[model samples]
Target: MEWLVSGLIFLHVTSGAVALVTFWLPLLLPKGKQAHRVTGRVFAISMIVCGVIAMVLASFHLTSPQWVEGAADTRLQLGWMMLYLGLLATVLVLFGLKTVRNKGRHHLYKTTWILFLHGALALLAAWVFWLGWSQRELLLIGVAFIAFLMVPGNLRFILRKPVAAPGKLRREWLYQHFTSMIGAGIAGYSAFLSFGAAMYMPTHAFNPYLWTIPTILGVSFMMWLSKRQPRYD
Candidate 1:
């Protein structure tokens, strides 16, 4: 059982590292190019792999608390947080990839599975919020607030018919793709900083603010990127 957890952790860290590196490649490279597409695909797959492993690890933490080296309540809280993050990462990457694939065809993107994913996240966000409020955990509350903001926009994007011009529709897809992929990067970096880096550093030396650094930087960059309308070639 210990070996299994270690193996999952190893895979999760390796894949997350790959994702963090590749997440920037597509943005740095010329968009719509072959290299950009290949790197983007790699990043998306890495994120999915990492997210799945996280969910599995979370399950172990939740169901087999004896294996986890923490207080029972702490383990349970961490398990739920990990599971939420895992689902968030998976959904973001899939949504980003789907936007690109369904370019100009918004209807194709509004599948039942996508809707279900959003719904699940929404419910999870509320539960996390409640948990955070009850426990007075600011991080979980902040995360839930962000989730609340995101899920609605995603749902609106899928449900709303594209009444705009064809070019506008294309741009909307590009924007969503950029936002979702970068958002996944933010999650990846936050987890690494908060959890992975903490493992190496002394508990007292680790600043909780490190968790918000990625989010602030990522969101600022995303906003700047959103302003520049790149050609959707």
Candidate 2:
């Protein structure tokens, strides 16, 4: 079992590294070019692999709650975090790719992979928050709150009538792709920092501030890039 866990960790980290590196190439290269498409596909596939591994590992930890690396409780906490992060990463990448392939057609009302996962994660997030509250783990509570906030948008999806964005250009999908891919980038960076950089910076390594820095910077950059890009309408 331990060996299996180790192997999964290796695959998860390796794929995450590949995702982190390849994701940048698409961002830097000219859009609509072969290089961009190749790199973007590579990034999406690697991230999917990474996310799957993470979810598997999280399941293991949640079931067993025992680890060679940390206390059982700590392992469980990390497991929950990984589960949420992995879910977000996979959902974002898949949706981004689907949006591109759909030729700007996005329907929120109909059942979709993302909507299904989003609903599942919303429940998971509440459970996580309750667990954190019981244990008085502030970091877990904060993480759960962040995760919970990701779901309210689904209300818009289910409650409001499905309507494609106005205008022939329909640039909404591009913005979705940008934000989703950037979101995956943030997850990859956070995982690297938490697991990889934490080794070198033992002190203050697990600080929530450190984990959130990538998200802050990524969102800011996404906003700036959105403004600079051409609009659909």
Candidate 3:
């Protein structure tokens, strides 16, 4: 069982690293280029593999507490963290893919489904925060807040109106594509910073500054890059 967990960890880390690297290639390359498409495919596949393996490994931790060598409380905390991170990363990437494909007007059914998921997640996060406050679990409270923030964007999709064609008036699909991909990139970076390279960081590395770095950088870069996109004229 130990060996199996170790193998899953190795697979998860390796795929995540691949995703982290390949995700940048498409951002640098011109849109609609073959290289961009190929690299984007690689990045998407790697992210899916990484997310799936991460959840599987987290399940192992949750089911077999004896297999974990850390303090019992710490192990349990880590298990829940893994599950949350895995779900977040996987769902975010999947939604990013969906956004790119949704070039037409938003469908009520699709938006409603997504809205339901985000609403449920937001409620869950609120419950977690309340529970954490009662239990004095600072980590849980912090994570729950982050989860709450993630839901707001999904909420927007439900309220958004139909958009014009590409470059006509509001290039909604293009904007969504840009935002979703950059959001995925932020998630990839955060995972790497929190887990892959965590050994090099200080013990008190879970602060807001550390967690928000990827998001801040990614959004700034996206704004600049989107400006460079060719106009319809």
What is the C-alpha local distance difference test score of each model? 0.82, 0.74, 0.67
- The ten-residue window of minimal lDDT in model 2 covers 153-162
Cα lDDT for residue 67, candidate 3: 71
- Consecutive 10-residue window with the lowest summed lDDT within model 3: 197-206
* Model 3 quality (TM-score): 0.78
lDDT preference between candidates 2 and 3, better one: 2
lDDT of 1 by residue, 94-196 (tens): 9999998988787798799999998998898799789888988766776666567667877888999877656543468888888888878877886777566
Instruction: Indicate the residue-level lDDT of 140 in model 1.
Output: 70
For model 3, the superposed segments whose C-alpha errors exceed 4 Å read 108-147, 163-169, 197-208, 223-233
Candidate that scores best on TM-score: 1
lDDT of 1: 0.82
Q: Residue 46 deviation, candidate 1, in Å?
A: 0.5
In model 1, pairs of residues that clash are none
Q: Which stretches of candidate 2 lie over 4 Å from their true place?
A: 107-109, 129-138, 145-168, 197-205
Q: 1 or 2: which has the higher TM-score?
A: 1
Q: Total clashes, candidate 1?
A: 0
For residue 81, what is the lDDT in candidate 2? 74
